[model samples]
Target: MNKKAIWAIIGLMSAAVIGVVVLQMDLIRTAVKVNEERFEKNVFAALNTVVRRLEAEENREVFQHSINGFVTAYYEEHDNTGEGKPEFTLDYSGEDGRPMLSPKLSHSSLLDELMAEFANPCTCSQCMARKDNTYRSLMVYFQQNTREFPLEQRIKLQHINGVLKQELGNRGIDTDFNYGVFSREKKSFIIVDGHYVVEDAQPKEILPGYRNIYNSRYKVDLFPEDMPSPGLLMIHFPARTSFVWRSLWLNFLGSIFFTTIILFSFAYTIHVIFRQKKLSEMKTDFIN
Candidate 1:
């Protein structure tokens, strides 16, 4: 009913507005962070699914090369770095003493060739043009790890040799594959004996994005538990903007929600002040 009361209400409303604005920012940050985290976690999970599948499968050479081609192209298109990349590796020594298969290989003469092959043969007919040339003397090494509970060493070694031998044999050329299991005690790598031949019937592609249509089956359930395991490709998750955005978004959303409440409170205060003023005027008329 008094001027002081009206001014007090106005001040409170003003403070409410300011509070709402400040809190809104925090809400928005919170919401965005939470959403982004969920997104990133989902993406990481999808990637992990691929990793697990590759690891679980006995043979991974073809799949590794195919995925490498796809991922390399995908990252290049987005201008993203292959930081904390998964351990899917391609090491190949060409005739020129250069590692031709891995994109990370220094002195990559086959970059153009690889890109062309992957884009053309791997891509659809209407996709893009690609060159075709099977480079000779290219040695590729493919490795993946399998970890099952109730640890068995022999079985692990058998898996390592079997996958490698089968893959190499399917490619139609025989090569000696050196398998050394890493050790902390011996400080030496042991040799795995086997001559592998890639057959003509079940041909394996050494190039990226090439497919292998093999139907031969090998018995893998009889290996001993003391066999040495092969090295695995590492998958790392680096600090990314996705992580930061996820954190910020959660805070932002929280701020926004609080801000909205503050605004509503301010509006209600303003309405009450006007109603009180109208009542005061009516009381004055009655007195008059």
Candidate 2:
């Protein structure tokens, strides 16, 4: 190929790469920001309902049942089984004058109580560990098929970043927490993605008070009688999307694609520049 043509190709390739990178970065950032806001609002809304119900009932037993039910329902509905069954079955007296099961919380009294208790803080360590009500609320919210705020309606990127930074700082931790939010584009979806490890300076100790509350709240023996201390709280912060491939592999592939495009473009540009200089010298020789 002629020197000019080679140079042109190199220039075009470089421009193309720069364009793709700039565009992708912006799109992903926007997507991540939009998703984060959607998560905050939607998750909070679900949690608010639970809080209101909890406070209204003030019955520790019933409140525990509702909260646990919501959590169970969330996991069950999102289960790998692919069964589209309702998680919480409402038990009540039917027209047949017998008890029946349905996927409805017909007991408004129970729901009302749950909502109320949810409104008030449980005054426990884990709950008090974080200051924000929204995050705390998310720790225990449950509802299904509600209209979520549009991506635009979500919080701004700066705001989200600020809140997270502040929350982490308050906990005496330093780490970049990358969050993304997306919806299944279908009715009632559950997604799990994005994970990072948090290192604890102190030995993993589930404070007695916190463990007791979690035990009562979830009805699960999270702390076994056998082990003294679990030694770590694995914070599995979820993403709005499911990963089709492992994250490490995905990242590796992306890096390779980006690097190849840049390196090839640079090498091609250098080759074209030298070729052009050579051609110009030959033209000079011919003219002399």
Candidate 3:
């Protein structure tokens, strides 16, 4: 090929290599962005799961308390009356202040009466009103008795750690994490990892390495229905960025390897073209 043709081939090869490099960079960038978003999504989901589990635990306790109260009231009425048949009144006082039943029965009879009264009911106004009154009173009782303990007493650091680790691991994220429960009422962190931050104390100053715990990207409300103000659960992963990038290392290395090979081939091809051109000129001179 002539000099012009040889230079044209070199320019085209250079442009191809540059384009390949740009494309590879863009692909890596896009991959990193996608991985970051996936990581965030998983973390948020895990936080929500933790919050829900905590709420369920509290609800279970409240329900158990309500059942015990109901059973105790039944026995008390029976003992006071000193009769085989006792009148039981379920007076769950709330805003409505409506009386559900004043039945003359025994414990077993009461259960049967309750079933007969509430279950297999027709669409009558009286039955519907009774159902609505019963539901509202129970809800009021639950709301009134829920979360009687303080935030610190209700939540344990070990439980939080265990649940968070399990939930995050379930979502394929296992990393060293720092978590804190910030009490909105106290306006400070009640607990952070292994230590408890006192009211009005600076968490950053108290826990040097756990500075990010308060400003964590992953956060959810703890006991949202807690009176006055609800607490916040915040989690920060120190090694999250490294962990996310680790997954893309192989792709990055492979791209680099292939790109290197392409450049090497291009260089060798140019070198061979120049060498042939030099040899052709020498042969022409010798022939002249």
lDDT value, residue 282 of candidate 3: 96
- Residue 8, candidate 1: C-alpha displacement in angstroms: 2.6
Clash number for each model: 48, 24, 0
**Best prediction by lDDT:** 3
lDDT of 3: 0.77
TM of each candidate vs. truth: 0.29, 0.30, 0.76
* Candidate 1 error regions (>4 Å): 21-25, 55-269, 285-288
Q: Which candidate gets the maximum TM-score versus the true structure?
A: 3
Quote the lDDT for 38 in model 1. Answer: 60
Candidates' C-alpha lDDT? 0.43, 0.41, 0.77
Query: Higher-lDDT candidate among 1 and 3?
Result: 3
Once model 3 is optimally superposed onto the true structure by TM-score, how far is the C-alpha of residue 273 displaced, in angstroms? 2.0
Query: Which candidate order results from sorting by lDDT in descending order?
Result: 3, 1, 2
Q: Is candidate 1 or candidate 3 better by TM-score?
A: 3
RMSD of each: 21.5, 20.8, 5.0
